[model samples]
Target: MKRLAAYILPVVLLACACAQQPQVSEQTTTDTSTTTPATASAAPSAYDANLAFGPDKVVELKQPESNKVIIKLMFKNGSMSDPKGKEGLTYTTAQMITESGTKDMTVSQIKDKIFPWAAGYGANVDKEVTTFTFAVHQDFLNDFYPIVRGLMLNPAFAEEDFKRVKSNQQNFVDEVIRASSDEEYSKKALEDLLFRGTNYQHMVEGKTTSVQNITLEDVKNHWRNMFTRNNLMIGIAGNYSADFLNKLKADMVQLSDAKPNIPMAGQPNKPNGVQVEIIQKDNALGSAIFTGAPMPVTRSADEFAALMVANSYLGEHRKSYGKLYDKIRTTRSMNYGDYSYIEWYDQGGSFQLPNPGVPRTANYFALWIRPVQIGEGLKQQYAELKDINVGHAHFALRLAMREVDNLIQNGMTQQDFELTRKFLRSYIKLYIQTQEKQLGFLMDSRFYGRQNYIEELDKLLANLTVQDVNNAVKKYWQTENMYITIVTDDSEAEPLKQALLNNTPSPMSYSNLVKEGLPKEVLAEDDQIANYKLNVKDVKIVDSKNTFK
Candidate 1:
C-alpha cells in the first residue's frame, strides 16, 4: 500500500543525487501475525508487537545482505500543524533542518565530509507527516551517525539558511509550479478545491504570501513544538549492529518528551456537482486536467483491496494497460497518459511508482489527465478539424468520466477482473525493490496500523473475488460529484469553460494521414464520447498569476 518510488526531481537532483543506488534486492520481512484471517481483520493488529522498540517508537527491517543503511524519521506533524497565519512553518522548518548546517559544522563542511561516503539526506512534508530520510553505505554508518544526529538535534537556524529556504519555497509556489509544470499546478489546484476551507487546503510549501509572512523565529518555534520524541517514529534498514541501534536510541532521548497536540485533518468538503476551477495562464501549449472526489476510505478500510483492483482496471498510474489509457491515449492519441489513484500519489509526473511516507487520515479518488494539446499545437497535430481552437480537453474529460461511470454502472467483467487482479498481484511486489523504499513502506504500515502493507495487500488481493471488486466499486465510485481543475492557455479558457457548461459535443479530430489507421469500432465510440454529458454545476476562471497568492 505504501510505496516511495522517487523523490521530486529538484530535491533528488540537487540534494540527494549521490545517494542513488541500483536496487540489489526485493526482499522484505513478512509478519506472521498478518497471515491469519478473521472477521475483524480490517485493521492490522500486530504492527506494534512486531516492531523492535515496541509500541510507539521504532520499526526496523534488517536486510543482512544489503550494504547500504537507510534511516527514515517521521514526525506526526506536518503542514496541517502550521499555525493559522504561518502556513509554511512546518515545511520550512523541516527544510531548515535538512538543508542547513548543524551548530558545529557549516553547510559546506558537512557536504565535504558526506561527499566521500556518497551519502545524502532530505526532508519531505505532506498533509499529516514530515519525514527526514538518510542514506549511506554501511561502511560509513559509524562516521555518518553523528552528522545525521546533529541535523536532527542541533540545527544552526542561521539567518542565511532561513532566508534561502524561505525564498526557495516561495519561488516554488509562485513561479516554478505555475510556469514550469502545469501538471503539478493542476493537481495542487484540485487539492485546494477538494479540501477548501480546511487545514489541508494549502500546499505543503504553503502559499506565496503565507511563506513570505513566515519569520525565522517561526521555523525555530515550530521545530520545538512539533519535533519531539513523542511525535517521532524511527525506521532503519540494512546491516547494523545491535550496539549501534542502542546508541541511536540513547542519542534520541535528548529530544524533548513533550506530547504533540497536533489535530487530525478534518474531512474535505465534497463537491455538489462537477465543480470546476480553470486556471488561465498565458501561452500554454496544452491543458492539464485533474478530477477528484472524496473517497472516505484509507488503507485500513475493508474495501481497500477491492477498490485497488478497480482503480487499477480503470487507470493505473504511469501504466499503459489501463482502460482509460487504452481509450484516450492509445486509441485516440488525445494526451500523454491518463491514470487514477485511490490514495495520495505525490509527484505523479516524476515517480513511476507510488511514493511512501505520504500517508493520510482522509483519502480521495483522483484522475490525472496529463496535458492535452491545445491551440496552434492542436491544430497543427490534427489539421483535419477546421476552426477547432479548443483542444480535446472537453472530449478527454468526458471520455475519462464516462469510463468511471461505466465501471460503476456495469462493473468489470470477470475476464477483465481476473487479468487486472493477476497483474496487481505481481505488480505490487515491485514496490519494495530497494532497502530505502522497503524501510519507508514498513514505517508507513505502522502509520496505517498495518504490519506490512505490501504483504497484507498481496494477501488481500489474492482472495478477492470479482464480485468483491465490483461491489466495492458500486459502493464507493461515483461520477456525479467531483472537483475538477484545468490549467490551459489564456486564450482557450473562456471557450473551454463554455464547452464544459454547455456539454458541448467535442468530436475527435485526426489528420487524414493518421485517420486511415483507425478501427471502425474506435470511430463508432467517438460519437458517444463526444456528446457525453457533464453536469457542470459551477465554473470559476482565475488567472494563473492570482493562484497560490
Candidate 2:
C-alpha cells in the first residue's frame, strides 16, 4: 500500500520508444446524445463506415498493423449506486461476475483453457463505472471471446466464491488498510471527512460491517437490476475484424433490457474552515498527511485545461520537478514524496498515468504530503532539537499550506507557466501507449460528453496563455478552508493535535552534519515557515481500531 510510482521514467521512455508505431487517428462527431444507442440515421460517417456506432453502443479504435485485440465492456453504475445499508453491493457484485465462474465453466476450468493463450480478462470497479477489460492476441480472440461472453451473460454466483470475495473485502477494510499502509489509510480518511454525508463517503470496498452483511442473494439481485442495456457501453481496439465486432455486439444484446434509475452523486459537504481528523495508530513510524477541499469544476468545465497546467506546476504525480516535491522531499528530505491533484488520481502509488475508466463528475483539490519521520526515527536523526515530541508533522503541514497560499496570492511566473504547459502537451501523449489504455480513454471521453479528450486537452494547452492559468489558480484553488487528515503514532496524536490548535512554532530539525551544509537564507526562511498561521476550526482524535467500523 506504500507503493510509489518509481517506474514513471521508464514508462515515459517506453511511450517515447513506441512513438513511431502506427496509430488510428481519433475522429470527432457532432452528436450529443445520452445513454440510448445511436440510430443509423444519427450515426457519424466514420463510425457508420467502420460499424463503430449503430444499434449497439460501441467505441472502437482500429489499428490494422497490430497483432493484439483489446475489448472493454463498461457500465455506468458503480459504488455510488450502493444502498444505504449495503454500501459495497455494486463492487461485490462486479467481483462475483468477473472473478467467479460462468454457468458452463468452473473458475479452475476457465483458467486452464485461457492459460495457454497468454491472455487474460479482469474487472475494475471505480466510483462511477465498472469496466471489464480483455486483452489477447488476435489469433486467440475466437476462443477468448466466448469465455468473456459467458461471464457477462450467465455468471454462476457460487456460494464459495461469494464467501471468499466477501471475506477478503472485509479484511481489507478491517485489517490490511489500517495496519499495513498508513499512506492509503490517511487518504481514505480524508475522503471520508470531505464527503461525509454523501454517497461518495465510503470506500469502494465499503466498510467492515457493510461487507459482512452482504449475501449471495444481494449480489444476484444487484446484478439483475443494474446490469442492463441502458447502462452498457462497448469498446474494442486493435486489429479486430468487423465480423468479430458484430458477433460481440450480438451476444451483448442478451443482457436485460430493463433500465434502473441510477442518479449521479450530489455535491460533497463543504468545509467550514480548517477541519481536521487525527487518527491514532499504534506502532506507526511517522505521520501521513492528506489535505483536500471540494473543487467545483470537472473535466467538462472550460477552466479545467488551465488548472491542469497549474496542477502540473505545483506537483505532477511522482515527477520530481514539481514545486512541492522540490521543497518538501528534494530540499528538506522530510518525506518519501509530495504531490498534488486537481482531478481524482486513482492509485497514485502504482500508476504513472491517469487510469481511464474511473472518471467522476465531481472532484477536489488534494495535496499528498507523504509520510514523514517521527518518534524514535526523528529523535535519533535530530538529537539536538528539544521539544520535538511530535517530530516534523506540524512544520511539514505549515510549509505545504504556506506554499499553496503563496501560489494563490501570486500565480506562476511566465517562464514557469510556459515550461509546464509545453511539458504537459507532450507528457499527455504518454497516457495511451497501449491498445487497452487507448480504448479505455475513448470510453472516458464519452462519459464527459467529449469527442476526443486528449486531443482537445492538447489543443487547449497549446493555445493557453499565462493569464489563463493564473486566473484558474485564483478561481479554483485555496488554502483557507480545507479538510485535513493525519495518521500518526498513538503516543504523538495528542501532542500533534495541540500543536495544530495552538498554532505553535515548529522549527526544522537536522543532524549536525547536515545542518552545517545548509545556506544562511534557508535557515532564515525556516523561521517563517515555523510560525505560519493555520486557522484550525475543529479537531477530532480517533483510535485506529475504531475507524471504518
Candidate 3:
C-alpha cells in the first residue's frame, strides 16, 4: 500500500526532487511491468517484481507521472571499509566523485553546466553502505546523464578538491559537531562506547586526526576497493522512458567489478555496571545524556516488530505521546524532549523516519535526553533545594532510567499498547509518503533481507498482542547494566559522578504556590525511584577538544 500510494497521491506526496533520465534507444530492452493496485488477495510481488539491469544490479522503480526522477547508486561498502588511519576515506571519495568535477569537466565547469539544468547530487554515507543520489527533470535527461555518468566513472580527483573536501570534514568535527552541540556529542560518544574497538566506532565523516592523515592516494585506493559493480545497487523513481532506464544501467556497468571483502563489525563489549565517559567543557551549561545497551536483534528478528510497538509506547522519536516524553518533558518539563530507539536512528532529533542505506548488523536500544540547563540559577534550584546538588544531566538520567525500570518491571498497559499500535498503524504512512522516501525504504527493505519492511511490519502489528510487546521488551530491553555517555561542564563532572556513586535521591521540585506539590501517590512512587541505586563500573572525564580526534 505504501508503494501504491506514491503513484496514487503523487501531488500530495511527491515534490520537485528526483533523479536522472537517459536518452531513448530502440536497441535497448526495457521493463514493461504495469503498476497494480494493492488488495488483500494480491501478493506483494503481484504489485511489482524486483527489476534488474544485469546480474549484479538491483533496481526498484516507481513510475510516477512527474517529470522529476530519483536515482541512487548504493554501494555495499561505507566508512567500515575505510582502512585504519584512513578513516572517512569512503566518504571523502564520495564527495570527490560527486561534488568535485568529473574527467570531462573541471570543478568550475561542472558547476556551470549543472547550474542551468538545476541538477545536483547527494551522498549518504553509513557504517555499511554509501549511496550516491541525483534528482533531475526528465527534459534534461541526455544532458545530465553524461555529467552523473562522468562523476561515477571518471572523477577529476584534483589535489585542490581533496584538500577542500578533507578540510571541510575535519572542521565539522572540530567546530560544528564536536564543539557546538552536547546533544550530538553525547550521541556520538554512546555510539563509540556501544561499538567500541569495531570499524563502526568512528563517525561517517571520520575522526579529526583520521581526516588529517588521509591522503589523496588513500582516498583513491579506498574508492577503487569500494565503488565497484558487484557492490552497487541502483534505484530509480519518477517519469522516464524505458530506454532511459536501460541506458542508465548499461552506463553503470562500465565500472569495475572488484568486490572487496568488508570485515564484519564485532559486537560491542557489554559493561558490567554503569560505565560513563564525560566530556568536560567549562562553557557547557547543560549536559546531553545518552544511555543504551547493545541488542542482538535486527529488523529480521521475529521480536523486532513487537519491540517496535513497545519502543513507540516507551519513547517514540520526536513524538510527545510516549511514556518518557510524558514523564520527563510533559509532566516535569525537565528538557526539550526524551526519546528512545530500538534500531540505529540517524538524525533522530531531526527526521521522523529512518534514512536509507545505513544498515547495521549489530544494533542497540538507546535513549536521548535533549540538552537542558545544568547549574547555578533557576536550573540548579531544582537540585539545590532538594539537597541533591547535582547537574540536570544526573537527574534526567535517573528519572529516565526509572521509566525504563518501570517499563521492564511492569511492561505496557493494555490501553497504552492498543493506543500505540493504532497510532503506529496510521503514523507509518507518513514514513514513505513521497516517491523519493518510498524508494529509499524499499532499498532498506532489501538490505535487511526482508520481503518488505512496511508490509511485514503492518502484518506483524495487526496480529500483535499486548503480551507480545511486553515479552519482546523483557527479552531485548535492559535497565540493570548499560553504557552512559554525558557531555557537560567540567564543573559538573565530579558532582555528577559523586551523585551516581552516592545513589542520590533527585525528587521533583515544584513551586510553593501549587497546593498539590505532586500527587501524594506519585510522590510516594518517586521516593523509591529517587533512591534507586546505580551500579558504577567506571567514570572518566576527558577534555572536549580532545574527543573525536
On lDDT, the candidate that comes out on top is: 1
| Superposed model 2: Cα runs more than 4 Å off | 1-56
Candidate 1: regions farther than 4 A off: 1-53, 380-383
What TM-score, over all chains together, does every model reach? 0.90, 0.92, 0.87
Candidate 1, 1-549: lDDT as tens digits: 111211221232122222344222221334343232222223222332222233446777766766777888899998888888778788888888877889998777888888877778878888999988888878899899999889888988889988887888888888888988888889999888899888999888888889889998888878887897667887877777756766665556455555678987967788899999999998998999999999988988767999999999988899999999999898888788999999988877778888788999988999999999775676665556657957878888999999999999899999999999999999897887666677778888888888788889999998999999989999888989999999999888998898888887988777776678999888889889888899899889999999877
CA RMSD of all predictions: 7.3, 4.7, 8.1
Name the better of 2 and 3 by TM-score. Answer: 2
Q: Candidate 3's residue-wise lDDT over 72-183, tens digit each?
A: 8888887888888878788888877865787778867866776666666667788888887777777887888888788888888989988888778878767777666778
Candidate 2 on 139-225: residue-level lDDT in tens?
888988888889998998999988887877888888998987788899989888888888888888888888888999999988988
Ranking by lDDT: 1, 2, 3
